[model samples]
Target: MKIDDLRKISVIGSGAMGSQIAMVCALSGYQVTLQDIQFESLEKAKALLNSQMNKRIVKGKLTEQVVEEAFARLSFTTDLKEAVSDTDFVIEAIVEKLDIKRQLFAQLDQLAPPHTILATNSSTIVSSEIAPATNRPEKVCNMHFFNPALVMDLVEVVQGPHTSDETAEITMALSKRLNKTPILLQKEISGFVANRILGKIMNEAIYLLENEIATAEEIDLACTKALNHPIGPFALIDLTGLDVHYNVRMERYAKSGDEADKPSSLIVEKVERGELGRKTGQGFYAYN
Candidate 1:
């Protein structure tokens, strides 16, 4: 389908990424449905988006009327079928698990219209792994959006061999409509482009923390001052969620059988303690 054909969009999952992505689409004038199985999660997402919009208006980035119009175009639902059945595009931003993603796509393939494009916001799992579960493999591609989707400027659009030229082109066009920079990778890789490079820094940072070479604060300061990165590896993981980090590593190790792909001891411990970053109010660094 062409970019103009994509009028109604459905986003599965109601977490930070999913909510912000829905916001992006809604603000861009697309009718957006943000879906989650739990009613509480949907409520939380609505509240979070409202608060964020208000903040933007207060900062003069958007007018009150514009925020209201965007919210008018946005809706939340607990019913999966209702969310995607008539939508032109579906973006899955659920937990980073292969089996779960595959299951979701299989259901979405059955529910959504045949012409709907299915995309994933996963930064780790490639679309190829989940596309096999769906009949429309060509419509499935990785549309990885960085953390704080509303703020991050770069989106990685990875097209696997099964992805069609039209699918990739339309996704790139949609990204532009959302007012963000989009890079297309004709070939698909596990971590895509940015994450693969970022993963290396995260790995070494985890090692340093495990070895007690430096405190998280000290390391973060070094990264911000010397490397010119806005946030350090630990802080970045915290923003992305420690459970996500642990899961991505575990998933990689399961596939590659590489010891290096296994989650670090620090990550495992943090996840076990339920210190899953910003949402949980604590992670590598405490929030509030």
Candidate 2:
């Protein structure tokens, strides 16, 4: 289907990524439905969206009328069937578990309209694996968005083994409509492009930390001062959540085929202890 034909959008999972995606779609003038298993999570998502919009208005980035119109275009529901019922596109931003994503797609395949596109906001999972769970494999692809989806401009539009050319084009158009920078990924490489490069850098950083070669501050300083990176690998990992960083690393380690890609033992131990970084107020450096 043509991108203009997509008027209604559905986003699964009401976490930070999903909620922010809903905000983008709503502001883009698409009718948006944000869904989650828990009604409370949906409520929380709505609250977060409103708060963020208000912040934008206070900062003079958006007008009050724009915020009101955005809210008018967005809705939330816990009923999976209702959420997927009439959507032109479904963006799945659920947990990073493969089985969970597969089950969700199986449900979407049966619920969404025949021509509705299915995209995943997954940063690590291979699109090919998730595509098979749906009946329309050609419609399933990856539309990975950065964290805090509303603010991030870079979006990776990934094509799975079975993804149709139409699906890629439509998503690219949608990304542009949302005012994002869309980078097409022609292959299903592990971690796609951005995350794979990030994974390599993070794994090496952890190795240094594990070996007592440098403190987190020093590492962050090197990237910010010397390399001119806006954020250091360790700081970025902390902001992204150490638990998430370590978990993705483990996935890469399993599929990366590079010994250096394996996560450091120290990283696993930290995540096991629940030091999830900014979200949890602690990580490589204590946010508390």
Candidate 3:
């Protein structure tokens, strides 16, 4: 199917990423459904989206009429079948766990329209690992959007071996429609492009903190002031949530069986303490 054929979008999981994605699609004039298994999760997503959209209006980035129309175009549900029954595209932004993703894809494959394309928002778990769970492997590809999807500009579109050319092109086109910069990876790779580069930096930052070579603030300051990076590794981790990195590391370790691939001791402790970053009110630095 062509990009024009995609009239409806269903985002599975009502967390921050999923909610922002649904809002982006709706704001771009597509009908969108944001789905989660729990009612409370859906409510939180609603509040989160409303707050962000209102911020856009306050900043004059978007008009009130436009935000209202975007809100009007969105629907929320707990029923997976109801969410995907007529959707032309499905973007999965649930947990990073491979088994959970495969299970959800299996269900989405059975529920979504036969012509719908399935895209994953995972930067670490490539679509190749999840495509086998569905009959339409050709329609499965990676459309990894960075955290805080509404504000972040970059999206990585990964085309797996089983993915069709049309699927990749359409996903790229759709991402552009959402006003995000889409970088196409002709071949699938774990962590795609951006995250792979960022992971190395994050690991080194964790090592430095663990060795007491520098504190999180000092390391972050060095990255910003010396390297000229817009944000420090530790600050970026906090913005994106430490749990996400922890899961990526865990997944890598699970597959490689190498202790070196395991999450850093610092990250493990932070996640254990529920200091997941901006969403949790604390991470490397505290947020009010």
TM-score per candidate: 0.98, 0.94, 0.97
Off by over 4 Å in 2: 256-261
Predictions in order: lDDT? 0.93, 0.87, 0.93
> Candidate 3 lDDT, tens digit per residue, 1-288?
999888999999998899999998999999999999999999999998889888889999999999999999999999999999999999999999999999999999999889999999998898999999999999999999887888889999998899999999999999999999999999877878887888889888989999999999999999999999999999998887899889988998998899999998888898999999998999999999
| Residue 175 shift from truth in candidate 1, angstroms | 0.4
- Give candidate 3's TM-score: 0.97
Clashing pairs in 3: none
Residue-wise C-alpha lDDT for candidate 2, range 159-202, written one tens digit per residue: 87799999999999999999999999888886888877776777
Q: Determine which window of 10 residues in candidate 1 has minimal summed lDDT.
A: 201-210
Q: On a 0 to 100 scale, what is the lDDT of residue 259 in model 1?
A: 96
Against the true structure, whose TM-score is highest? 1
What is the lDDT for 160 in model 1? 92
Cα lDDT of model 1 by residue, 166-210, tens digit: 999999999999999999999878898888998998887878888
